[model samples]
Target: MSRAGSRDPALPARPRRTELALLLAALVLLALGFASAEGDIRGQLSGTVALYAGALAGAALALHTALRFLAPWADPLILPLATVLNGVGLCTIWGLHRVSDPRASEAADQLTWTLCGIALCGAALAVVPRPRMMQRYPYLTAAAGLVLLTLPMLPFVGIDAFGAQRWIGVAGFTVQPSEFAKILLVVFLAAYLSIKRDVLSLAARQLTIGSVKVFSQPRMRDLGPMTVAWGVAILLLVGTKDLGTSLLLFGVYLAMLYTATQRKSWVGIGVAMFAAGACVAWALFGHVQRRVTAWLTPFAPDTYEAEGGSFQLVQGLFALAEGGLTGTGFGQGRAADIFASDSDLILVSIGEKLGFTGLAAVVVLLFLLTERGFRAALESREIFVKLATSGFAFLLAFQVFVVLGGVTRLIPLTGMTTPFLAAGGSSLVSSWIIVGLWLRISDAARRPEPAAEHGADAATEVLRLRSG
Candidate 1:
């Protein structure tokens, strides 16, 4: 008979049934959404529906096949969840396109970018056979990230649009490098913290008022790196004039630091620093002041007519109000009336047409993705993988919060795009790449132990029992 506790070595058929099923479901849901928006709203069928569906299905299949063959043990939920979210975005954009500029083919462009992003994701998986290998180049990745963040400010190459110089133009194409910078910076922090975590956690001073200890604070010497990080964030704000990305980068750093050191005091310090910086920026920058004014009193005529007016913000709120409970139903809503409906105000558009029910579903999907990233981090064997995965998760969570909160007027409108659901090619591509990295890390964390190792342990146990 077979040896007791021995396992099959013939590569277990991880056929990924769950992924295939979910992909099919996502495709059907997308098709139904397109049909509803087209037939119910426009009262006719368009040729582009078939084209969009075919492109999405093909792109999803391509990525799915790659993961199955290359990273079979990868988290099955990430790709499928991304597919559903991307599909919803495509349908929504297509619906918006019908009203905004029917002839522009922006929906088709989004589909093309989605394919490119999937291809890039596949390349990432192929390039980094193991996620742990990335720990080797923390500083190099950090340097590259900084360079990318600074590129959009270059004299000739930089493109100024929507009051922020956050994109670089090359050969007629504009690219936002900040999206990719988030990933590289996360990598750097993960590697850096993996080495310094023990020291940072242990070398903290406890503070007390009289009898009760308030909190444990890091040493003044240890504060140098965080202070430097703060300066870099401020520089990013001043240089690019992009508050969303600057906030995102800094929020991610703070989260990673806390996760590494497990110090609640870091949270207090980071918040205080961010608040102080925001006050300074508000006082110094006209644009910052205008955004705050708009958020506070958007309906005021004076605020409404300014350069960066509250017109868009007020309109987005009206759109959401129009959505109400069940939404205006696909294409029936006036989401297109709002500026940048497919990007900065996408949540508003989604809220308007899909209503509270649909919007809630979307939010749940986002949180689910974040949860998977956190799960990967927890399961990871190496400290670097854990911190990196956690950072990526926090990045996604914080970004979604910023986008949704801004659109709802809970916070000043920051020019940030909703991931996967937004119109920007750079944002879409970078989101996919982050998902790819999460999958790689999850695969490494969850892969089955070698049969030899298992058998060896069983044999050792049996020998001990025999001796006893």
Candidate 2:
């Protein structure tokens, strides 16, 4: 019998057949949806259909080819899953165009954004060949993140729409700075936490509610980081009024800290701080108060009609109810009736059209994506990589929960977009960049160590010298 430590035969490199098949299936589904929605396969194919189909196919193939060569050991399902969801979203948006407004170019625009997102993903993979190198610039990333987060609050460039200053206008293009800022923020948190994990885990104080010892708090120095994070979150609330982005960034920070130290005390402290901050915002800001009130009493007539009230929330709930089982079948439901069906409420539109079954599939796909990220985190050799990958994974999971939970009336609406399904260039691009990071990290983590190669090369050199 072979010993456990003995080397086995080399495994063949994966050709990614599963990924290719899934990609083809996703493209087929997109074409089918377009054909069905238009009711004219021949004419649509001769014009607009060909353009989107070609673009998606080319983009998918380009990314796949890059992965095949650049990162063969990376998880295969992630890219294809994102592709399928994105394609379905494009189809759904295309269908909603007729119902919401004819001549709307949302689908075409989304396709262009999708292509741009893929291009960015490729660029990220090329630029950041190794995930470990990112750990060297924690301060730089943190400073850049702060700048990006603050950009949308500037008077000259910032645009206030829908009662929130969450966008900056640049050259006639509106960009959501918080979307990209979150990525930079996560990287900084990961790098910082990896270095301070030991110091943070050290208990500075023991607290007891009554007789039972509850939790141990970190030192004053350790507390400084959490304070800064909380202050930033509060600033975000006061400045941009974007509860979702603030909550997301702060939540990611807390999670990474806890993950680094395995300390429940940190989470408890974070939650308590969040609650306090939330109460203060509720007391100080009328809009924040209105949101809490609407969340608690959405069906109230006054609350439903009030500006920024539960009207959209009530409409979304009604739409979800209408889409009982298998959905109203694409393009059959009046999802367009709800405001912003293409962005914040895209999931509602999806629920109305495809029903619970389709929604379940989307949720499962998200879970799978998040699962892959966690797996990479677990397998990674470096502490920074582990923390960064896990933090990124949690960000995706929490954002989905926040968005879906908000629309379902399970929580207050926070005006966040569903990852790939939502129609926003900033969101789409950011999510794709996350995907690139995941793939790059996973490839590095899973690829066999080079010790064996070095050993083989040394033996070859020795043999050549002896023969000579």
Candidate 3:
């Protein structure tokens, strides 16, 4: 008999069928959304709608099929959730393109990138069947991450756009290396911390005031990792002027550190260090000062009218206000009038067209996606898988917070793209790769234990011996 047939009847069945059902439902919804967007943009549905919908469905189904064979026990919700978000992005971008100049239309490009991303995601699953294999090359990944992080700073390659030096133009293509770098660094951190969690978790010194325990500190030697992370964050902030990435890199580091060590003091010290660095940057950098000024008084005529000031911020706020509770309905809104309506300020565009209710629904989906990552982390058996999965989850959560917080003025506007929803090939590709990693880790976590299978075989053999 097959091992699966001989196994205990009570063992949980794989949910691959459920995954297929959800994937189909998500694709159906996306098709409807694409049709609706096309109708609204052109005043009638075009045949191209069918073409786009078919392509999207085909890509999604391909990924679903890969998971069925490669990762049958993986979480079912992740692929569907990602599909919904990515489809929403495509529809939104298409709508914006129709209303804007035809010469600048990016809908085709976005679709192509989406397909490439999904293909890469499937390829990731095929290549890395085991997540633990990555743990062996922590230092190598770290070195590669540092190189990518600094690649955009090299002369003759780095290109500055929108007041930030964060992209490199090579062979007629501009790429943001930091997007890929973040994942590599996360792997490095997870691997490093998993091996050192015991040392980092144990308190080396206890601070006391009048016999009252105040705080516990990690060993001075243990501070090397934090110091390196802090210094890298500062360098990113200063060198690239990319506030969003710098904050995200350091934030994920702290999150993974705490996840591995469970040390609140480490978090406290990291935050304090970052705060000090931010203050110094504010004092020393003109761009930092300008951003702070814009955040503080966005509506002031002087700030609003100045170059690199709060014009985009105020415009995004107006778009959100116009959207109000029910939104302006897809292509009807003027969000496309604002700069970067498809990229950095996408959340505002979504809020303007989809309204607060639609925005809330999107946020809920994002939360569920992040929750699934955390769930995988909890279910995982290996420390490395847990930390790596949780780190990726934290990266997604914090990136959303930074983007939404900026658009809403809860924090200074940081030019960060919304994952899966923004029109960036680099971001989309990296996101799908992260999804593949999540699937791999979750499969390993939820797969039936080999030990149990062996025990079942032994029990069956003993019964045969007695009968004989």
Candidate 4:
């Protein structure tokens, strides 16, 4: 029987040590932060601590309750990893808020968003049955995805953000559809590619390359759907000015396709197509030109005037440059006064305050998560599971590469948040939700006997006897 359905008896379930440790460490850091900021806030620590503590407690309870029920097969580390990173982010946000921008109490807002994201991750973990089930709803998922991708297009619904309409205000709260759309698209792509991988792998004539055989380019039968999908994505992104999401999604599609087939040729073709697409975009799209120019020379702060396009990026570099090694210290950054501080420039603020060490720690956490995710993918038995999970890893790696590189001037400005660490409802929610899916896949691919394995020897012996 699958571990999910096991009627294991004599087991005394409790929180994993890692979960407890995470909460304890987070609570400690949170307490220290509150104490340090007590004089500044003036008798507000009691209230603020109560609020934040309550939120953490509630999030932990919800997550624990979820693992006990829905995804008994899930990894114990996934939720805790998310909680730790997000908790640190919000705490740091609050710290920055205390000094940098007193008018902006981003801590409270970040806490609220973290709770929402935790709730989302918990719910998804609790009831997502299996990651494979997502394949059944590709059409619905894809449609919803398309609507989100087009949302920034509607002036009424979309918020004018960094010259890109990436947000929608519902009632009063803002949401980024592209964040959620990326994951849904991954599901759709996994479903589509799993079925298509075999055909694409088998149907082709071989050509000799330096006495080595290579498959020629895909025929019309092979190219039609992939081309159409690519065109649709490109059209929507170029039209709406959502290049970051578009490039991230397109990169994911190519990575998944190659993973599904183990073909170097597909990657070569993808790179060629990307170069071609970039050339076309640069010629036709003026916005692309500005972004590229800024990426190449973000240090040109004088050239980045109000009328120009590189202001955000130039300011970002200034923030990073100001933050040399040990940082300006928590709650002691000057960059928060800059426009869009909470969104695209959060990383810069982090660099200014947390220094290179803090920045490196955040990156390392992400690297660890990616490593775990890729390991999960490698261990997966089902092709769909492997492709989908690998896609998750690839998406994180590439998205980080995009956003961090953008802020650091390694690439053009994408204005996207640093996943798990950046302050955005869209980024937080989508990242946690993807973690849930990755956890589910990891659990399914591995952990065949979870509840049983976690149980005490005495309890297991009793259960074994009872079963016998």
Each model's backbone clash number: 0, 0, 0, 0
lDDT (Cα, tens digit) per residue for candidate 1, span 119-228: 88888899988787888877788778788888988899888888898899978778998888888888888888888888889998889999998988887676565456
Judging by TM-score against the true structure, name the best candidate: 3
Write candidate 2's Cα lDDT for 1-468 as tens digits: 033433333321453666788788888877776776665212343356667777888998899988877877777777888888788788778778765676788887899899999988888888988887888888788778888888877889999998899899988778898888888888888888887888888756878998896988888787677457546744864678888888877788788888998889879988998899888888888888888888999999999999999998889888888888888865567678778888999999888887898888888888998898999999887888999999889999999999999998888888899998999889999999999999898888876554434578866764553232
**Whole-model Cα lDDT per candidate?**
0.84, 0.82, 0.85, 0.73
Relative to the true structure, candidate 2 reaches a TM of 0.91
> Any idea how many clashes model 2 has?
0
Off by over 4 Å in 4: 1-15, 33-46, 449-468
Tens digits of per-residue lDDT for model 3, 191-298: 888888898888558789999967788887876874576467448646888778989888998898888887787799889988998898899889888899999999
TM-scores for the candidates: 0.93, 0.91, 0.93, 0.87
RMSD of 2: 4.9
Q: Write out the backbone clash pairs for model 3.
A: none
Q: What is the lDDT of residue 6 in candidate 1?
A: 53
Could you say which candidate leads in lDDT? 3
lDDT of prediction 3: 0.85
Instruction: Please estimate how well model 1 matches the true structure, expressed as its whole-model Cα lDDT.
Output: 0.84
Backbone clash tally (model 1): 0
Regions more than 4 Å wrong, model 3: 1-14, 452-468
Better candidate by lDDT, 2 or 3: 3
lDDT of 4 by residue, 1-468 (tens): 424747444231333445556666766665665555544445445566667766876786677666766655555666666666776677667766666556675778888888887888767776776666777766677777777788877878878866677788999888888788788778877777777888777676667789888755656587576567656866787777788777888888888878777777878888898899889889987778877877676556554763546777777778888888878765455676776666677778777776788778778878878887898888877677778888889999998898888887777777767788778788988888888887777666654443554568856764563232
- Among residues 3 or more apart in sequence or in different chains, the pairs in candidate 1 whose N, CA or C atoms overlap within 3 Å are none
